[model samples]
Target: MTALPPVVDEQTWRDALADLLVREKAATKELDAIAAARRRLPAVKLPEYRLTAEDGSSVTLAEVFDGRSQLVIYHHMWSDGNRWQCSGCTGLTSQWTRTGALAELDARFVVVTNGPMDEILAYKKRVGNEMTWYSSAGSAFGADMDAGPGEGFAFNVFLRDGDDVYRTWHTTSRGAEQFSLFFAISDVLPYGRQEVWQDVPDGWPQDPTYERWLTSKDVAALYGDPEA
Candidate 1:
């Protein structure tokens, strides 16, 4: 059995929480400053590249913005002929099933994978995913952006100026975790995700990192709520 946090008097708990709140507020302020700095980061002009659309149509990188000025792409990992998809990427994509809110900010989010269009659509339907997905098949867009076929995942931001496109920022691995609500919520829990890497109290349950991630199908089966 996992050990629980030590019980304390109500007043003592409140006092401890108050102290933690101060640090939490400071962290929030620091994050705000970081975001401000990111806004000032310079972007690089990208060469013209063609990408495959959902219907197997060819589209320019600039056209991907869909008339929006800013574009966010999650470079979803894909391996040809592999029946099992990357569960981590699948879970991450699931978090953004609906992106209408981001559209209001003049930004569009989509998934770009190196897999073939037919297979991509099949998996999208099987997983009941709603976010717009595109394929980088037969294009250098994935490799130039550091998310080549069979490579790991990446999150990229782009700025579209008229017909021109520029790469603003990109991050992968742990950097993408900030966009996950699961991690944010787990951080406040008692066992704290039950992950071995976490600095938790002795006797607390801990398993291999990422072993707790739930695929879209798992969610649907467990909760009876499939996005499709």
Candidate 2:
């Protein structure tokens, strides 16, 4: 355990908050500019990629667009011979279980993983996810698109134009955290994710020692696998 922040007078806290507002406003504007730039980034034409669904149905990358112009594929982390799922990937799915914006924005969002089709389906069922998921194993989709080596999480953006699919953008590792709201909320917590690496204030409650205590398997054990 670590000591909590000290209680200060209201006026003193107000002054500190007012000072922080300047930085917050600047960050907001900078982020807005970055998004604008991201929207303008050029896209690359994709190949004739084929992926399989949990039901063993064959689907093309363009088909994944599902008639939507914009498509977002969440490349979940799973691998062959690995029994446990990626904790970060699991965290992302757990937080972002559903979204109404897919239809509103003329977009379809799906999850993809290289894990065995059966294992992916079992994990999906265990997690109680309604989102459509696909297996990109033995497919160029994962290898060519930088989804990482079987156990890496990534958010890949795609665009569809009259039956042709194009790769717009993709982010992996810590950058993929943008797809998860848990990180944003965690940023507001006093401990701030409780990870060993964060440079939080001294004496803050956190796990300074790195360990595997927080992971997808932990989540599964705590929440109970729905399939089981």
Candidate 3:
């Protein structure tokens, strides 16, 4: 077994926790300040772009909001005609099983990919993904947003003002971690992700970063998809 944290008297443990709590509260306040600054950031109006819906129907970017004032589009990574999707993107997508609560906040969450609609739908079924997905095929929607075919993934936020749409924020890489409750929960565990990059006790287990990311096969097992 790996080494465990040293045992201490109850009062000593309580004192250690009190010290950590002080830092945790300060960090929380800093995060709140950051969010306040983010809200004050200016947004840019975007040009018109058409996207293909699940029914093969064409729709405008503004219509993606679905009558909501705010929209959050996860720019899913996809390889044209490839059945093996990006494991990282697939795992992150799987974590978003329930999004109905976001609607109460006047925000609609959906996914857009550069893959062809037909192939995307087929893959979605094979993986049992429930999130509403659209295809940017035959349009500049993906490229203009820096998430074209095979260009990686991103989370793009927008605001709708009647027929006009404004780009509010765009984040990729680790920024997308906000959507992953799995990561949030892992962070509180004793091993704390167990990744080589993280600081841990010398005897603790550690592996290369992302070495254990979930794959389509993992999702298939969870969802009971025979096709995977």
Give the number of the best model, judged by lDDT: 3
lDDT preference between candidates 1 and 2, better one: 1
**lDDT minimum window of 10 residues, candidate 3:** 219-228
Q: Give all TM-scores, in the order shown.
A: 0.93, 0.90, 0.97
Cα lDDT tens digits for candidate 1, 1-228: 648788999999999999999999999999999999999999999999999999889999999999999999999999886655787887777777668888899999999999999988877876756778899989999999999977899999999999999999999989998989888899998888988899988899989987788965674454333443
Candidate 1 residue pairs in backbone clash: none
List, residue by residue over 11-87, the lDDT tens digit for candidate 2.
99999989999999999999899999999999999879889976899989888777889998888877666656776
Query: Every model's Cα RMSD, please?
Result: 2.3, 2.2, 1.1
Top TM-score hit: 3
Model 3: per-residue Cα lDDT over 124-153, one tens digit each: 887778999999988999988989876989
Q: How big is the positional error of residue 115 in model 2, measured in Å on the Cα after superposition?
A: 2.3
Please identify model 1 stretches exceeding 4 Å from their true place. 215-228
TM-score of 2: 0.90
Candidate 1 local distance difference test against the native: 0.87
Better of 2 and 3 by lDDT: 3
| Full ranking by lDDT | 3, 1, 2
